[model samples]
Target chain A: MTSDILAEAMDYIDDDLISQAYSYSRGRPKFSKPLAVAALVAVVVVAAVAAIKYSDAFITAPDSGDSSTTAEYFGGFMPDKISDGELEYEGTPFTEKEISTFVEKNKYDLIGAIAAEYGDFESVYKISTSGYSHVNLGETNTLKYDYVDLPVCRDDEIIAKITLFRSDGGLSYTISVRGKAFDKYNSIYQGNLSAELAFFYYGFEELIITPTNHIYRVHGTEETLEIDRSMNYYEKYATEYNTFSYNELTDEKKYITVKPLPEEQINDGSAYTSSDIEEETAEAPETSTVRTVNIYVEDLMSEEIASVEWGSGYDLMLDRPFRVCTEAQKSEMLRFIENMKPTEAAEPVQYYGGGYIVRLVYADGTRASVVLMGGDQVYFETSEGESPIYVDTNGNASALAEYIVSLI
Target chain B: MDDTSIIKLYWERDENAVRETAAKYGKLCIKLSENILNNKSDAEECVNDSYLTVWNRIPDERPDYFSAFLCRIVKNLSLKRLEHNTAQKRNPEMLVSLDELQECLPSDNLPEKSFDARLLGKSISDFLRKQKEVDRCIFIRRYWYSDSVKAIAEDLGVKEDRISVTLFRMRKKLKIHLEKEGFCL
Candidate 1:
């Protein structure tokens, strides 16, 4: 009986996939020309399609007027006759063949161009990965961000695929004009975030990673909540949040340090070391224990008030692709947030459908936004980090955000 | 009616091709389009247009593979709608999805060939077909279907972190495959 039911479900799912396949191919134009015209169009289309093989390096968004794409903005991939090892712009899922082809084609530029670019790039360590990549251009504030990507139909590796950004916005010089390009992969080391912790969206709370690699989950609430070696890491070892390593008690070294979030931390999923749970919990240090999180909340929602002290230890966990913020910076930001007055969030004017998100624009122009749907639940995200924070269903949305701001 | 019967009816120009096609694959198409377009009327229009387009083309062209053919038809129609409705932020289900795949591809121009688009199209399809059913379905749902993180979790009975990790890994796999197929660098 179960098998029969499963079969029916499978059939239904297959039919659905087949039906939805159309949506996957959205944005394609319908071309119905005369047979001869179609024949020509087909040739062109086919040729264009075949050009999917043209993997080239290109640059990504360079703020253009209006909709943002300019003709020159789309630079062509240099021929692949590499005399040296310069990073090549192969398409996503790059095959060795494409790289070889690119290398071979650009080789002629050898000592003259591309090789020199790679040489200069190689002079500095260039790292890239599936997620995002960064290059340390030294104190000069010269940094570049490279995004791995490709466009439709064109073989040469485009340069823009790897997004290069500097804290000082220094990729400003005529790039590639120097022809010194070397690319590195898997360079940035984002610390481990437990898969379990990955589930909670810290909303606006900042993740503080001490130089010792101990990660503190701090939220700037009306009071201030900072979890670290200060009080006790074992106290919350296994509660709404858990941390094992940083300050494992004597025999407690056996407690497996599991990141609260298993997924975000990748391989570090959930670790188990200690034999006794109760003992470890009871031995938490009281002095360093973080109680309140002072948040400099900029935006306060309707009917929500900031609490006076640390409330229930928020079960909130910071989500990754989180852009880690520093303590000093957080303090500066919180002060700015508290002085700000709460304004009525504009009624969501039919944004695509029902409601839109409320955006918080900081004095420095930094922005954080909270999207509250029907149930008053909040999903907080910022322009910098990749992760989003989810506020508790019962907590005051304003208090929750204010708390996070205070922590930031 | 079965899929084969609908194709036959479509070619015969019974004028009820749309109705019959809807009967056979309406919900399926609707759900799929809804997954991507997220609009009832737009999804309905896409399916109807697919039926109409199929009806007009089938009399002259007979396809050996019916499902793939219908899928391609609907897929093209949905793309067209996305382009037409660009005034608003009506991104198709694959907006962020395709972005994930972007990393694995060459960071340059898209490949150019006579049949490159179709080839890459075939490549994606084949790649998808090769994935484990549950994993593939997860990818399609999160991506092609535009299902939210919550929806995918509820339907699959798995944790959201699992889905997120799975997606990240899946994109990596696709990226690796692209390198094998020699698509991007």
Candidate 2:
């Protein structure tokens, strides 16, 4: 068994696996813009400039004292008009009526926010399409839509693929306690998340949420989202600080606490920004083919692994759940078990009737009482731990164990 | 420099908008599409399509995260192309896989209760990470790290019938697992 252990893992690497992951043979998606590098570099530059400029403006109150005229333009006093939990738009640099009108005009993303406070009046009536903007995630996908030409609104998510344009009359969308976002006074606000808004306002990267789907790129770290009114959100989202009312705070004025949505539930796929929009198909003829490249992994480099069965005397000593299998498969599994460091191996043993307990030993001193059914149903698990080792993020597993009374 | 400004550059008919986008999300798009299509030409097509999609859709729409926005388009385009190719080839697995999701995933009729594609994807990943030893091995052997049931079972020394039943139950478990995570969104 020991001799066989060293060679087993080497046999498993399968050159096909690497190629499959690398080549995307199973109809995976590809991003192929010839000038992507230049685009990325420019984005960095732009982000830097926006960061520096907005950061400076956001930290100071836009209407700290000298800007009374600017204060009157934004209608910012509305926050005082509403009581606890009541949703209102008056005095809020953004008006409810404005978003409703925006949605009505575009009529592409037929999704309307059922006012969390007042169910009667639909909030943000902007945009629609009978299609009702939607998103569908499958086995292989990690995405966030932004700066797109389309809007997605559905019962589950409100994903706006396009970013708010500053040169336009629109403000970036704003979120209230009522669970909704709206962009009014286009160019006044950019419609980023509270965190993004904070960064935009404060000029500090302290508040931006990296997003969940991006966690893979961030090495799977789960980060929490933060938002506070002490930060002037308007400065980052609003292109024109004057969009706020007398009392409303702009980048240089006062800080209003903003609560970011719960990080756990934020659909990163729904995040969008303006500059990112040009990346999508822009008014070009549909001459480019539309498609998705999902790696089926199952289609390429499939190889047969040996299956094993537990011989007689395995039924009596077993406790709760039990399964059976062949010797060949068992040997192969045992070899795999031996390959793992001692700390990783499951305990191996063969339980028999009539008071006889025999622990099966692998060549590498690995012991297991595992049961493998016939064919390739290999059940390799550790009784000591809660989770098994071979599963990937998409719920893929290494094997399962089931007890079989008879042979096929 | 702002994505908002750059998008405006496009709507205002500025070609430098293309240069800006290329500077920001080009490699990410190229890599993503390339991973899916395997062919550079097809990958390029998907990326360009993504660009076109963004361009035509932006006037009435506003997004906060451009990378995610672009990624979704590229991914969807690539998947659509892949589906077309696979359908032309008459692959039974595609139909079976899709049919299996009919009961839980999004479709034309289901709205009030639908699954979060991203969360579901994550839940599946989480579930895989939680599987017990033998079960985990079987899963990897059948899905990710490996390919087919026959190969997985052969590697593990299990009967084909046993493997089939286990696979069935595994699928069932996955459905149940998703439900537990509020996959209905």
* DockQ, each predicted model: 0.03, 0.01
Compose the digit string of candidate 1's lDDT tens values, residues A255-302.
Answer: 111112222221231221222222332343322211112222223322
| lDDT per residue (tens digit) for residues A120-201 in model 2 | 2223322221111111111111111111112232221332222221112333321111111212211112332222121111
Computed on alpha carbons, the lDDT of every model, listed in order, comes to: 0.35, 0.32
How does candidate 2 fare on TM-score?
0.24
Off by over 4 Å in 1: A1-408, B15-17, B35-38, B64-67, B109-115, B142-150
CA shift of A272, model 2, Å: 70
Off by over 4 Å in 2: A1-408, B1-46, B56-65, B75-172, B179-185
Tell me the lDDT of candidate 1: 0.35
Best by DockQ: 1
